[model samples]
Target: MRNRKLFILLCLLIAVLVIAGCSKTKQTVTQPAETPPAEQTTPPKTDTSTPGSGELKVHFIDVGQADCIFIQLPNAQNLLIDAGNNDDGQAVVDYLSQSGVSQIDYLVGTHPHEDHIGGMDTVFNTFNTGKVYLPKATNNTRTFEDVLKAIKARGLTVTPAKAGVQLVASEGLSAVMLAPNAASYEDLNNYSAVVKVSFGQVSFLFTGDAEEKSEMEMLAGSGAATLKADVLKVGHHGSHTSTSPAFLRAVSPQYAVISAGAGNDYGHPHREILQRLSGIKVYRTDLDGTVVFTTNGQAVNVETR
Candidate 1:
């Protein structure tokens, strides 16, 4: 009887243990898993600057008595400021081709004057131009009309080269228009667009034939103090009519570039303007052939032909 009672107790204990194990197993199988938290992140800023990578290079092409500064962006793209005179259009195209410029990201006709927009039509027809910027002023010259016709032919339109407009050149690089602040001007030179091209810490001021009237307005504008740059493309080709002392003082550039023809009639880089630019390093297109400044954003290396 004692053996039978012991056997029965053992069987009952074994049944209870098995039931408890099954209940625990079922509970564990039915339990829901805990979810993980979502991660936080911010989208990076968009760099809309046209294709470019590597060092930035600015080439002040030797166009006699005219202006045509070709900027090679860090992204390997090109931006032409002006294309010299009408006769120099083919030269600009050939130069670009030799420099491996397959396309022009930006083309700027600072003013409607022939000296600025003369070769613009040829450039527009020769290479694919991305965007063109022109000031509000009009000269009604054949050169200006040619540019307009070319733009229309390319199914493109000109964007007003006004203050505050920005040119996205590349990542960490850009340019902003800083002049032609007024609505009207009697002199076409005063209507020239002044653009400040900056990459990293280095900056360049390209004043397209802007005279005292424009300079005064620029000084009176909001970005007056921001005109400071490492390089200044002297206005009116370093003529007595422009590059006023006040303008020079404000810009305080380390180097000044004057674009003029050798033995030109206007006597560009006039004695008075040269006197004003005494302390600043001056490079004339007539003397330097083609002046090139290459920058790795912070510092620059200048080379001239």
Candidate 2:
């Protein structure tokens, strides 16, 4: 009887040990593994895949003694300022085509001068133009008439390019008119439209052919404080009649661009103007061919054709 009792106790102890082992194994198998944390990152401001998230390009086309600028905005929009002389129509069109431009969001004539608006009719006829901005000043020349006819054909109305008018006012970009502040002026050049474009920290001033009179008016008005720019399209193609010393002082541009033909008769880019642009870096279409400036809201890179 003692032997049998001892045998039963031994069996019970073994069974208890086996059951504990099985319970521990099941617990170990049911538990989950630990996971690691993910890494963090910051995205860049400029992303080409999204609209308004890219660099800005300003192309100063070589139009020979005339003005024709094409601006590729960060928002994938295009702006054309002047179109050179009438004979330069085809050249301007070809240049725009090669640049992959199908439409012009803004078209500015600046003034009624033949050299400024001469090829405007060609541009209006060729591309799908958005808003046409012209100063209130008008001329009786055939060039001006042709532009009007083209606008009528396209069923597009004119938006006065005058003081305080804002062409674009968006986050990171702004284009405001600062000149032609008055309704009438003695010289036709005073009627030229002056546009100031600000892209983040970089700014550009485009003065078509504004003379001293217009410059003075801008200085005397609310626009004076905003004249400073990184680049200045020298007024009147570097003529002595424009870009007055006071005006230059106010603008305080780091770079100046003069658009004139090589060996032109009018003696553009005059000595007086060169002397005034002493410290500032200068680029001329006659020498640089086509000058391009690309900016990413902070830094600027320049290229010449």
Candidate 3:
């Protein structure tokens, strides 16, 4: 009888323990999958301005007695406007090489003037030039012949630039021809290819050797009575016959550069033009060597070498 009672008690204890474990297991709950925090995800940023950022530079070289402006494109291409007088060949070439240029995309001779196109022969022979731009006219001279010979020898083609046509300087920069418009003239100065370069919000006016006639005509054609520019290359090296008061009021450039040789016979940067631009800051190659303007699309800062 004692053995039977002990066995029944042990069985009852085992059943109670099993029932308690099942009850606990049934009450226990599982957690659902967690959602990720919203802040962990972000969109990438895009730059909308200065498409040519970090890749383009424009330089207004100081070649004595003439002008040579170089535009370096982001694509590693080059565009040179004028090459100074014949004597500046070596200097111009050295400058281009120092600036890390090995080839030229375009060479623009505003007109057939010796001062504008003389050193181009050296450039064509030294580097690979894609094309050469000359006015749709010419004033045949030795200087012109030299330029022609260089182009021909290099097997390069000549393209005529006309008013209202646009040329690319860099990815976002554009150069628009503004003068030598349809009306032919006897004066070489009148045939100078005036160009306006626009990059971002700033603009620069490059009037090769345009005189009063070209300025007046350009102003009349705009129909706005005025042309606004952030910087201006003073026409004909700030000659009295160019940059007339009326034209000054029209363009109203904040900064002007005069590319004239020291003690040149022309007596450029005349007092009259200086007086007219008394309110604006002026830079002269005669005083400073090479003048450079750097733009971050919104503003332009100038530096001299």
Candidate 4:
């Protein structure tokens, strides 16, 4: 009987050992609970523009003596300064479409002249327009009528092109109208809306066929300071009638761009105007074809096709 009790006690000790071994094995194999991931706070947006792309492209379309400036702002917004002649409407449309332009954030008709606004109607018809800007001066020609009709068709209103008209183009870019300060001018060209565009450390000035009268008025006041720009689109397609010495000195541009047709009877981009821009880097549509300048807010990269 004592032997049997010893066996039973030994069995009980073995069972306890097994229990302890099993508990240790479980503790060794068991893993701690994992923490879940944090929730996102930022809402989703449709902007595909690269935050640090650091480039703004400007396309100077060769419309054969007509003016057309297409700007791709840093914020991915597009701006069309002026359209070419009437026959060049389709060409401008094609160029914009090729450039993958889906919308026009700003449509500016610098003046009521046919060369500046003739193709605007086609642009209005081709792309989704955000806003329209035009000088108060009106013309009785069909080109002007077409633009007005196109704007009406799109159910958009025209904003007066006057001084101090500010535009927030992008996060670091803005444009302001610096001309058409006069309520009325004897010549329509005097009503041209000169725009000054700034981005970071760089700036551009677009003067639309403004002559001495308009320029003098600009110079008489804040024009000296306001006209200064890194680049200047030489006024009146380098016509001798415009781009006076005083205006050039006031602008002090590093680069000058002239859009004029080759072998034109008007003798646009006269030799006298070219001489004035001797110190500035001149890019002409007749010579450079489609001239482009890409800026990284500091340096301008020139590309011509």
Number of the top lDDT candidate: 2
Ranked candidates, highest lDDT first: 2, 4, 1, 3
Cα lDDT listed for each candidate? 0.87, 0.91, 0.80, 0.88
Candidate 2 residues lying further than 4 Å off, grouped into runs, are: 1-48
Clashes of each: 5, 1, 0, 0
lDDT of 4 by residue, 42-101 (tens): 223433444534577888899998899998888778889999999999999999999888
For model 3, the stretches where C-alpha displacement exceeds 4 angstroms are 1-56, 74-76, 169-172, 223-226
* TM-scores of all candidate predictions against the true structure: 0.82, 0.84, 0.79, 0.85
- lDDT value, candidate 1, whole model: 0.87
Query: Ten consecutive residues with minimal summed lDDT in candidate 3?
Result: 29-38
lDDT of 1 at 200: 89
Angstrom error at residue 265, model 2: 1.3
Clashing pairs in 3: none
Worst 10 contiguous positions by lDDT, candidate 4: 33-42
Pairs that collide, model 1:
52-74, 52-75, 53-74, 53-75, 65-261
Which model, 2 or 3, shows the larger TM-score? 2
Q: Model 1: per-residue lDDT, tens digit, 173-221?
A: 8888888898788999888888898888898999999998888888889
